[model samples]
Target: MTNRSTAIPQLSWSDVCGRRLDRHGLSAPVRDGTPADAVAAMCGAHAQVLSAAEVSIGLRVAGATRADVADALWRERSLVKTFGPRGTVHLLPTRELPLWTGALSAIPPSSTTMPADARLTPDQTDEVIAAVAAALADAELTIDELSTEVVARTSPWAADPVVPAFGGRWPRWRQAMHLAAHRGALCFGPNRGRKVTYTSPRRWLPGLQPAPAADALAGLVRRYLHAYGPATPQQFAQWLSAPRRWATELFDSLASELEEVEVDGSPAWVRAGDTEPPPTPPHGVQLLPYFDAYTVGCHPRNRLFPGPAAQRALAGGQAGNFPVLLIDGTVAGVWHQRRSRRSLDVTVEPLTPLTVAERRELDDRVERLGQILEEKPQLTIGTVLVGGHA
Candidate 1:
């Protein structure tokens, strides 16, 4: 731990970016040769959009393909897909699920978000959570099947409509499924045809158990600082989908293990002894997929994706709309891709002109993307809409 009287270092935007890139395993190719290493490096890969998660991991791990990621999840059991930080689907290393589950469960659920007509009583919620764990203990079941079991074990409340979505009603008790995942009780299994399935983590990973909530939360905060440090309490709260006051309290509790730092004039915290100047910026051009962890992990959106870059890279302030062109750890442009039987055409629109070297590096990264998808490359450079929508 750093001494209390240690002078805090002020980091430039470039320095912050350099350290983040290195920590995320993007400064150079990941030499570990395992998908779990890349996922673990970023804490976990954002997996709300499945294909985007595949591309995000493939870009960091050398020689990794989309199929390789799938194999690790389904066949190898080295990775598990579950609702993680911020209540979003994420691909987490199987061995680390306990820590994530315990930390996430520590956050009390918000009653404001629950619909009055479909809200479950506190006792009912507990019943549904237990039912979900039991129903999935030794079997893989689709949401429909699991819902049936939950209703049978709990009450009719589990099947009642909570709200309207996607031209259909969402049941109130479905919230328990999310809770079960956060409790380390359940995780996603392979798809059956077009339907998704859920299974018990205990069945999939024998002897797996969650650590104490306080210890797990501290560990999670330390890991977050390592990957996206110099972060404010609000930023940490946003990442975890918890209240700012809750996050601030958690941050204060860990002060003994953390040190203050300045980022672009804003005061933030990082792990103790991590106040050293960041390394020189890495040189390269890369395409980051939609919902990429690197893009989502960095905060203070105005700086990392400023003005036009933000408008193009993000949709209505959301960061997962389009694939982004990253130049020296900053968002410089946006891109989209279309695939044909014989070739893949990637359209790129740079907010500003790139240097000759940057353009060459861009091409190299494009070729690498092609290899990961098992498709031939065809480059098209121009302005394109977010998500490639017309």
Candidate 2:
């Protein structure tokens, strides 16, 4: 049973949004913060579309640019790109890798079953991972190079091209790539021309090791609550794409540190010290790019994507497929951007009528976006004809 009490604190949707946005650096952005600061605030930036991830972090830091983010990843080494939440490419703070690696490795495996011919058996998985770790320990290697090493180190079955991906088959050994990542055996290295490379975290972070699992997961839970609280274990599970039962038990293990609260009459939680209500709901316009941490992980989806937003901005009830327009903490519209040379063509379709001031704010925000992206932005206030993930 949960450590819930009758005296649970009550919060409205606005209260929840206000506090959450504040913690995410959305309500009051940080002018002095670095990309790492912004990245840690959002847990990590989803980077399937690296440029979009740059924008997501850049906008949260005043005067930050894509150059700054690139420097952090490649030069300063403050950020590490790896398979993160939901096993997607994400830019996580390097210093936090121990927490990330430990927690990720400890997660219960996904419930979805892969096809027999496409998946690795338990022994093969371990063998492939060991081969991967050995191959990347001292040098960076591309997936092809790693595959070659795996095939050499293991049996030819490790090289069997049986898994369908992106219209072609990937070698069976590639299936263990993420597993190797979670086990702290691999992470992204600098790109060679257009090809990606992988290196051992040991080589990259030197003397790096995952934190103890229980400690790391507890810290991750606390951090998640700090940013996205008045949230439930189910919501946390969705964010990490972790097993629901595992998430529930993890939260249960932290009952002493968490304070149960009531949000919009529904049960939720927050860090024990964060029981007080936040200042106020944020005002003005927010243009969030695809797969933004806020859009992807926020709870009470119906409220964030109220009415038309649910139909327009979300793909099958999942957010992050479309760039969103948030006004006063709720999704007010959808937007799209197309890059042209050094300029961006921005299209916005507002589901609600904007006041003259809101329109002006939007124009300023678009200009601000151009500043962050080092582009010239042209805004169209009418229809966004493009579909999601455009």
Candidate 3:
């Protein structure tokens, strides 16, 4: 059991949003330096869609190009791409891999919920995890190659089909891949042609040292609060893909370290001494790429993404399918882009009519996006399809 705090501070919704923008590196972009710096600021940028991850980081760092993000990951070795919170791929700073891995490993595996036929026995699962780590300890290998190695090291059981997915059977061993990544034993390497590859973080990231599990969990929670504070334990749990009880227990353990705050009359938590006034709302409009951290980090969908914006921007409550149009921090519409030869064409559809100024600002933002991609942009203002509606 842990001690709890009672003196909670009250803060407005706008204040929370403003502070989030500042903490998320949206108010003032981090100076162009390393992709690690940008990833660190955002806690970790969603990378399930690699291209979107590039754009997400590019939007927050001045003069950062997609190539720059790639260089940081593949060439400079400053960033490590791996499965993170919620079992989703994320790009994390190489130096912080230990913290992420330590915290992630602390979460008990949920494989027991899988149908018996689809689940690996506990001993089999452990063997598969160790085999994966050993195989990728020094070299990058594609899924097929890694699977072959696992079969050789463990058994045919390691390659047996666990369940059906994407119109085909997913092998039992496949689950171990996500497990390996979460434990920090494996991470994505640059694509080998059309096939993605994986490598060992221990071999790829030199001089890595993971903090103790408890310390790492505490640090991760604090970082989450800093980037997306005034948040509830349920929201935190949702973000981490952890059991509600586990999240609540972790929250209780840190009660003494966190300061209670009210978000729109609801209780939330922030880091102790994080009492600075919220900054002013950011000006102009922004076209946030798919799975942009800001869009995904702030929760309680009803609030951050309210009304028709929800129906249009999200598909079955799942984000990342379409890029979002951010007008003064809140999602206002959805957008898409296409490229042909030299010029890029962009289409934006706002839920409500925009003033001349807002339209102009939107255009400017699109132009900036073009600069980031190093291409000329052609703009088309129109309705964007969302939730099967136009």
- The TM-scores of all predictions, comma-separated, are 0.95, 0.96, 0.94
What is the C-alpha lDDT profile of model 2 across 74-159, one tens digit per residue?
89999988899989999999889889999998998886466766778889999988998889999889888888988999999998
Off by over 4 Å in 2: 1-6
lDDT of 3: 0.81
Model 1 over residues 132-236: C-alpha lDDT tens digits? Answer: 888989899998899888889987767888756688887878767678899877899889999999998876579778879999999999999998887888898
* TM-score, prediction 1: 0.95
- lDDT for 83 (candidate 3): 90
Q: Pick the candidate with the highest lDDT.
A: 2
Candidate 1 contains a number of clashing pairs equal to 0
lDDT of each: 0.84, 0.88, 0.81
Off by over 4 Å in 3: 1-7, 111-113, 207-209, 386-390
Candidate 2 TM-score versus the reference: 0.96
On residues 242-306, what C-alpha lDDT tens digit does candidate 3 reach at each position? 88888888988988888877777887888887856585755557898888888887876888788
Candidate with more favorable, higher TM-score: 1 or 2: 2
In angstroms, how far off is 276's CA in candidate 3? 2.6
The best-first sequence of candidates by lDDT reads 2, 1, 3
In the predicted model 2, the residue pairs found to clash are none
